[model samples]
Target: MKNLVILGAGTAGTMMANHLVSKLPKKDWKIHIVDQFKTHYYQPGFLFLPFDIYTEEQVKKVGKKFIPKGVNYIQQRIEKIDAENNLVDLENGTLSYDILIIATGSKIAPDEVEGMMSEEWKKSIFDFYTYEGALALRNKLRDWQGGKLVVHITEMPIKCPVAPLEFAFLADSYFKKKKIRDKVEITYVTPLSGAFTKEFCSKSLGYLLEEKNIKLVTDFAIERVDFENNKIIDYIDKEVGYDLLVTVPTNMGDEVIERSCLGDDLNFVPTHPNTLQSLENENIFVIGDATNVPASKAGSVAHFQAETLTDNILLYIDNKPLKEEFDGHANCFIETGNNKALLIDFNYKQEPVTGTFPFSGIGPLKLLKESIFNHWGKLAFRWIYWNMLLKGISIPFVSRNMSLKGKNINN
Candidate 1:
């Protein structure tokens, strides 16, 4: 039997497994997925955890529940990949594969930032990227009582780039509802030149940040955390004092990539921008946060890639030309709180513009504009994620490629 080995059974791998299992013949193809963890996390939900929007129970589920039964699920830590020999070494044994898929998702390592892992990590400084960090921050927030709360991003290319902004907005609302808005002072620290990476999106979001009275420290490169003095010092010697620090630390791809010597400086696999194939090996495919593509590391990007990869993998098996159709399509809902949110859809060639989404001239969702209906759609996504998205079912009026139907190209 031919081997099809998949690394990391997270969002991208799980979705690919579900999408490919029915397509590939079980008798001929022995599908094997490897990951150390048994529990899968709804990573997007991590954004809401600090604000008490999602509980611990809601964010986690057994990996086996999402993984298809026919596929062999190997719970093992990968040592490295010998791509030249087409073999992967794990803690237990070596697994050989005819085709390999790298879906090992990214992680936030606070240790990457100087002084972040020392002294006051979970006490004064906390991160919501992990379950433990989220719970810790939740407890801290519960008794905060009001002070200088700084929500900071250590670096860029973090999963869900919009999450930090969402957190800032939500915190503003949360404090207001708790009648402590005046008592609390919130500041947003980012490495980016604006609130968001994209210029247009940044323009809109930056204005919102100002309106909410959440201060923005842009273009500030973090040098270290001065936990001893209760401040964060930037490379330029500027410091921001804080009573509570909520941070999104440096995010990198799984350690397996680092061990395998198949990744870039940050352990992200070097992938063909348009093809979704690994630059080091054609037989290996990478998706989601694992790839060093200049695209948003969001679930929507992974879903779009899975469909194109499905076709490309089949083509590889049939000795046909690979279809290079993935256009960096990414869509995300930015929660602005108070029963309002904004949606943005764009690809490599296009930036987010004020328009409707999924349809031209008529949409149930508007892009880059706040509306209660958009908020409902954002909440409804959790259900859609589990049912339609994870199951490889298509979303209505949505396609993998960015459509120009409702987009204001002239603007």
Candidate 2:
């Protein structure tokens, strides 16, 4: 039987496994998925954990629970990928495959930043990208008595690019609810010149930061963290002081990609932007945070890519050309605060525009605008993620390719 191996059981790998298992014939092929961890984290929920919006139980479930029955799930650490031999080296044994899918995903490398992993880490310096970091920050914020709370991003292409901004907005709301808004000074620091990658979204989000009284410090590339002084120093020696530093550190792909020489400077595998095929090896496919595609590394992007990637994999097996292409379609819900959220939908060609989604002129969700219904939709996504997304069920009206039918092109 032909063997199909998928690395990592995260969002991309799990969805791809489910998609392929249903499509690929059982009599001809066998699917196997490998992951190191047992628990699959609802990473988006990590943003709400510090704010006590989601409990630990709400964000975690067994990795195997989502993996389909037809697929063999192996839980083990990956040693390296022998691409030349079409084999994978695991800590326990070796596995061979006719086709391979690398979806190991990216991780925050706090240690890569100078002094970021110092004594202050989890004490004064905290991150919300991980479960432990979120829980630790929750404890710190429990009695934080009004001081400089700096929400910083170390670098770009981090998973859920909007999460840090959401954290900043939610923190503003959280302190206001606690009657400490006037006492707490919030600052958002990023390497980018604006609030976000796209100019339209940046301008819109920047206004929100100003309106909320959260200071915006852009174009500040961090050089080091001065834990002793509770400061973050940029390349030019300009420092931002903070009593509590909530940071998103340098994110890198799995080390196995690096060891196999299959990745770029940041360890992200170089991939064809439209095809989702590894540039180095066509037989290998990559999705989610693993690829060096100039797209937001959010769950929505992965969900969209899975649709096209699954189709391409089938084509490759049949010696057929990949017909489907991913347009970097990404839709994100920006939780602005106080029961209001903003939704932005865009693709590789289009920056987020002001309009409605799924239908023109009329929508339950509006783009680049805040509303209570959008907030409810954001909360409802958790249910969709568990019940529908992981099961590889196609979302109606949302295509793999981005549609401009509802977008206001003039904007």
Candidate 3:
């Protein structure tokens, strides 16, 4: 039997496993999936946790539950990858593979920044990226009377790039609901020159920040965190003081990629932008936050990539050319305050434009525009993620490659 090893049973890995298992013949292929954690986190839900919009039970489930019956699920820490021998080193033993898939997504590195993991970490400085971090921040917000609440991004390429902005907007609404809007000051600090990486979206989001009375600090690369003084210093010595700091630290790929010497400076594996194949090895495939692709490191991107990646893997096995290409397509829901949200869809070639989606002028969801229906769609995605997405089911009207049919290119 030919062994197929998949590292990390996270969103990307789990989806790929389910997709491949149903397609590959059981008599010929043996699939093994490895992950350190048993619980699967609904990462996006972390954004709503602090606002009391979602409970703990709503965002977590057994990782093994989503894995298909035909796949071998191994829960263990990865030690390293011996690419020369096509072997994966685990904490306990080594597993040899005919083909390997690395989907061990990105993670927040608090220690990368000076004083970020200091004694004041949970007390005043918090992160909403992890489950524990979200829960802690939720508790902190419950009692925070009102002060400078700074929502800062340490760098770009962080998972769910728009999450910090969503947090800032949600904080505006959360405090208002608590009757403390007048008592709090919200500021959004980022390394980028604008509110977002994309030009059109950034302009629209920047206006929202202004309208919401949230201060926008752009091109401010963080140098260190002064926990003692409750301040964050930028590389140019510009300091922003805060009573509470919610930061998305420097996100890096798993350390195993570094040990394998198959990744970039950030430990993200170098991948073909179109094919999703590892630039270092033809037998290896990469997806999601693990690859150094220019796409947004969001779940939607992963879900989109999985379809193309799965097809390419089959082609590779048959000694056929990889015909499917990932277009860096990504769709995201930006939750603004007060039961409204904005939707944006784009690919590598195009920035988000103003128009209807799926069908021109007939979308239940609009692009780059805020609406109540968009907010409901964002909330409804949780159910879709759990029931349909992870199971390799295709979402209607959403193709693997992005379609510009409904977009207003004039924008």
Among all candidates shown, the one with the greatest lDDT: 3
State model 3's lDDT: 0.93
- The digit string of per-residue lDDT tens for model 3 on 272-320 reads 9899999999889999999999999999999999999998989999999
lDDT by candidate, in order shown = 0.90, 0.93, 0.93
| Candidate 3 lowest-lDDT run of ten | 201-210
RMSD of each: 1.1, 0.8, 0.8
State each candidate's clash count. 0, 0, 0
Provide the lowest-lDDT 10-residue window in model 1.
Answer: 202-211
Candidate 3: regions farther than 4 A off: none
lDDT per residue, candidate 1, 100-204, as tens digits?
Answer: 999998998888989999889899999888888888888888888999999999987889998888898999999998899999999999998988879988876
Listed in order, each prediction's TM-score against the native is: 0.98, 0.99, 0.99
Model 1 off-target regions past 4 Å? Answer: none
**What's the best-to-worst order under lDDT?**
3, 2, 1
